[model samples]
Target chain A: MTGDTELRDRQAMMKAALQAYVDRANAGDADGLVALFAPDAVIEDPIGSPLKTGADIPAWFADTVAFGTRITPVAPLRGSHANEALLVFDVEFTPPGGEPMRIRSADACTFNDAGLITRLRAFWGPGDIEPA
Target chain B: MTGDTELRDRQAMMKAALQAYVDRANAGDADGLVALFAPDAVIEDPIGSPLKTGADIPAWFADTVAFGTRITPVAPLRGSHANEALLVFDVEFTPPGGEPMRIRSADACTFNDAGLITRLRAFWGPGDIEPA
Candidate 1:
């Protein structure tokens, strides 16, 4: 395969991996969500402190699920390079006693040669979310 | 040039252009700094509203100069794509009657085929700068 072809393939794999994680998060499947990350993956949540390693992803997902948050991946994942991809999506969170609030978020993911996500950096505007 | 070589050359040009702007800004050379942007360039400042043309950049720079801000571009400009670059740097501002405060900023710039910056978006932590 040509370099361009390889880069495209890598980008596709990265997108699929990110989609899988989002799907699991929306479904409240903590195990499936955690499985998407590499063993040494790092997650920097827009709120709270950063989580290093895949082991911490479950707790992070649990917190979101507990808040009844559902994430929808938006179209056209913008990639900066072959091994790096940026995914933008909208997420809706429903508090236990309040209405649902929608927030737009963009995540930057890095993949290793094996196409496993090694790092996930999430970006979101603080004003995008409102108290319910 | 090979694809890799071409990409490197483009990155170098971008770095030089950004450095020129920073140097001009530090020297309060408004005209020289504004020349780096395309006529239809857009600038999204970290605070307040966004500017949507090269003509607006002069006003933005003047505001910074009035604030007595000096910007330093850090090394290793990270490029996501061949035509796009992300620059992370630090800026220090001194108020008229107060001490100096430093803020770290990251800018994402897009270049047109002519190598002129068509868009410049600045990003910085809200807490990075302290009231002086």
Candidate 2:
């Protein structure tokens, strides 16, 4: 394929992979979310938060996405030249007996050829949270 | 449709829109690139550069993507929750009778519901350029 076509195709694949990630998270399927990663994947959901890899990733998802947390894309998606991408969205976390808190943030991710995410670095902080 | 499917669909559309943008730029299709933006889209390429809007956007594309400049994504694309996203990539500019320079940068963009970009803020500086 031509260079443009190849690049466009890669972007599409990357987009699909990212969407699948959100899909899994939105479904509250912690296992599904973990399946999107490579065996050696690294995850830093909040940049400075504890780094997670391999078997440690699922727990992160379970802890984060549990209790009916939902994430929705608030803006358009942009692709970089490599298979790495940054995603910004609103994450709504509702504790069982607490109010919902909305946090706006983004994550940078890298994917392997198999389309599994190999690294994810989330960028956000308490300041990004929407006021109640 | 379920929320997951709807979200996936939106993500797909966003990816296609972003891909069209890079394709237009790589082909030196200045008009095509401009057409990707909404009528009143805002463009702040490099963030520090003069902001471009309305009729001024075409000139920005001409000046920036002109010559034999090529952009390649070094990372995957991430979509925000608001139809906005950030793209990180390397831009290679070969000035006529000048050496080629590769600069790494990222652009944060917002799109209208129609899939046309409404705002674009590029994040980069001279420091992001790679040494030959």
Candidate 3:
């Protein structure tokens, strides 16, 4: 494949993966959500949190599912010319020991050549989260 | 300063800089827009395009100003735990040899410790652009 076509293919894959991510999360399917990541993927939900990798990933998503999290797209999924895609969404969930809250989250994901997400850095701060 | 406070300060600066970016762009102030960048900043306007830096930065904004680009924030500016912020906005402009168009762009910006934008990678694919 030409380099240009290959790049576009990668971009398409990343975008599709982002949509799948939302679907899986909304469906509360922790396994499906974890499957979107590479074997050695790393994630920082809310950016400032500790990194979650390997076994931490599955556990993290399980917590997310347990929180009854629901993600709603705020804008169209953004794809870069490279192996990155941005998902802008609003999340509503109740965290442990916390009230129901809505968070305006923008996840910046980097994908591997195989289109599995290798890194996900979610952008959200204390100010972005508000009581629902 | 404690690490937590320092990190929060950086996050605040990044988020403010993003709001300034939107304000400068909407006001058609190319100079103001360029001032937000660090001296050695780099930008990729559509992710797939060539990187603009140094002398190219001013010229790129000049073209942007000439196009009368109007930026409207679609979602609240998102701040990370680090020196990064995400700006999700819609741009309305007329490109050379093209009709008026609106692009849904998500700019992932990395900031220097001094709060200037050091790297800006905009994520927007062809499908994200629509006739305005």
Candidate 4:
């Protein structure tokens, strides 16, 4: 295949991988969610310590789920190169007997040659739920 | 010009623009430094308020010079598109009769269609200089 074709294929795979993570997370499938990352993937969430490996991802996910946070990953902003992409969107969830909170975040994802996510850096603001 | 030639020209222009900023800052030429940005440009420094418009940039530059800060913009990490670039470098300076401080920062710059810088977002760690 040509270089352009290869790049296109890699981009498609990356998009699928990112969507799968969001799907499994929202579905509360911890194992499936963690399986999307590489063995030594790094995830830096906005409000938590960075997770450096696959082993640590499960605990992080568990904590997020425990917090009653649900993430709905939106469409990503494609970079010029297919190896990198940026996803910006909002998340909504409710705490125990409390009103729903909405958070907007931007995640920059870099994919390895194997099409697995190597780095996922998330950026968000810390604030309480504002009335809509 | 062809697409590749156009991209190359833009990249060279951007490199020159960034280097000019560093040179002028190091030489304390505040006027020349601010001339690089567009009239309505926006600059978000690391430890200060954002400066909007060309008029606000001089005060910001003057304050930085007064703080004994010297910025040396190193090479940029080029994005896929020539219009966007990421610059990661370190700055070193000493306060009045105090030890020198070195700070590492990353700036993402976006250029307008005319190739003038429209947005400059800076990121850095707040700390003292460590031993080399």
Candidate 5:
């Protein structure tokens, strides 16, 4: 097969996986969210924070869901290459005691050959979110 | 041309433009940065802030450079589609009365058929930057 065709196939698979991820998050299913990543995937919810890997990723997702966080894509999900993608979206959250908030952010993700996310780097900060 | 080939060519052009933007910014040439934008382009340096258009874009670029800001790409620049790309980089700032700092952020830029930026949306927040 041609390289372009292969890349196209990979893009399709990743897009499907991302859609499923959004579905799970919106459903508040932490376990479903965790199932999307490879067992050893590393995730940095905010690019500057400490990395979460292995089982910690699930815990982090659980914490996010527990905080009433919901993610919705704000733009078309974009593929950077065959195994990498860009997800630009809005994240809504209601903190424990703070006002509800909405943030516009993007995440750059790298996937493994098996279509599992190997790394997820979220690009957002406190200033990115506004009171909703 | 095939869709894939056309996309690849457009991607190349956009990448070159982005590189030039970073180079001009690092050199403190705000005019050069403005040259990259369409005459009536709109730019939102941070997703939630006011939009900068036409002559305002140059003013914004001037203000940023006047603050001793320098940009350097920290990751491989990614193309989202034929005319849109993602630039993840760091912006260094030294304020008039503040210490030097560094910000990690991303910009989603849309290009016109003529290869100029028609809209540039920067994804960053007050929290994305850190003390250098």
Candidate 6:
């Protein structure tokens, strides 16, 4: 494929991967979510939080799935000219020993050539959280 | 102030800078837009596009203003725990000799301690654009 065509294909693939992330998260499929990430992937949920990589990734998603997190996209998935995608969504989840809450989140994800997410940085400050 | 308090303040500053970006772009004030960026700021509009920095930054905004671009944010400005913020907006601009066009865009910006934008990467693939 031509360079332009290759980039276009990559954009499509990145968007598709983002959709799969949402679907898998909503399904409470921690393994499925983990599968979408590269082995060397790094995740910083809420940006300021600690990074999750290697085995920490699976553990993080396990906790995520246990929280019963559900993602509802507020805007259409956005793709870049490069190998990155953005997802703007509202997430509802039950916090440990607390009532369910909602947070407005925008996740910026970068993917490798293999289409696996290599880095994920979620943007959602404390002000974004509210009672669901 | 405490570290947490400092970070919170930074987040607020970042969000305000993003609002300024939208307002300045809509007002066609290239100088104002340029001022919000750090001296060493780098911008990649549409991600895959060429990077604009130093003198190129001003020229890029000059063309942006020349295009008569107006930004209408579709979502609230989202802040991160770190020095980053996201703005999802729809842009209406007139290309040279072409009719007005609309493009759905999501910009991720990283700010410096002084609240100036240090880096900006916009997400908007070909499919995200359409006739205005």
Predictions' DockQ, in order:
0.03, 0.05, 0.59, 0.03, 0.03, 0.62
DockQ of 3: 0.59
In the range B16-118, model 4's lDDT, one tens digit per residue, is: 6777767777888877877777878898654233455666777877766776667754433333233654454567776665687776554557777676788
Candidate ordering by TM-score (highest first): 6, 3, 5, 2, 1, 4
Candidate 6's C-alpha runs over 4 A off are none
The numbered model that scores best in TM-score is 6
For residue A100, what is the lDDT in candidate 4? 74
Per-residue lDDT of candidate 1, residues A15-102 (tens digit): 6887787777888887787777778888865522345555567777777788887877653444433366655667888866778887
What is the DockQ ranking, best to worst? 6, 3, 2, 5, 1, 4
lDDT of 3 by residue, A1-132 (tens): 227678778878899999999999999999999999999999988776788899999999999999999999998888876777899999999998889999989998999988899999999876687898
Chain A TM-score, candidate 1?
Answer: 0.81
Q: Is the docking of candidate 5 incorrect, acceptable, medium or high quality?
A: incorrect
Return the TM-score for chain B, candidate 2: 0.86
Predictions in order: chain A TM-score: 0.81, 0.87, 0.94, 0.76, 0.92, 0.96
* Model 2 spans with C-alpha error above 4 angstroms: A95-98, B1-132
Q: Who wins the DockQ comparison?
A: 6
Candidate 2: tens digits of C-alpha lDDT, residues B1-132: 125455455555666777887788799888898888899888876554577887788877786676566878755565543355555567888765678787766666777778888888765533355643
Better of 3 and 5 by TM-score: 3
| lDDT for each residue of candidate 4 in A20-68, tens digit (9 for 90 to 100) | 7677767877778667777788886642334456667778767566656
Clashing pairs in model 5, backbone N/Cα/C closer than 3 A: none
lDDT, model 6, position A39? 91
lDDT of 3 by residue, B1-132 (tens): 227778777767888889998899999999999999999999998886789899999999999999989999998898877677899999999988889999989898988878999999998876678999
Model 3 ranges off by over 4 Å:
A1-4, B1-5
Candidate 2: TM of chain A?
Answer: 0.87
Docking class of 2: incorrect
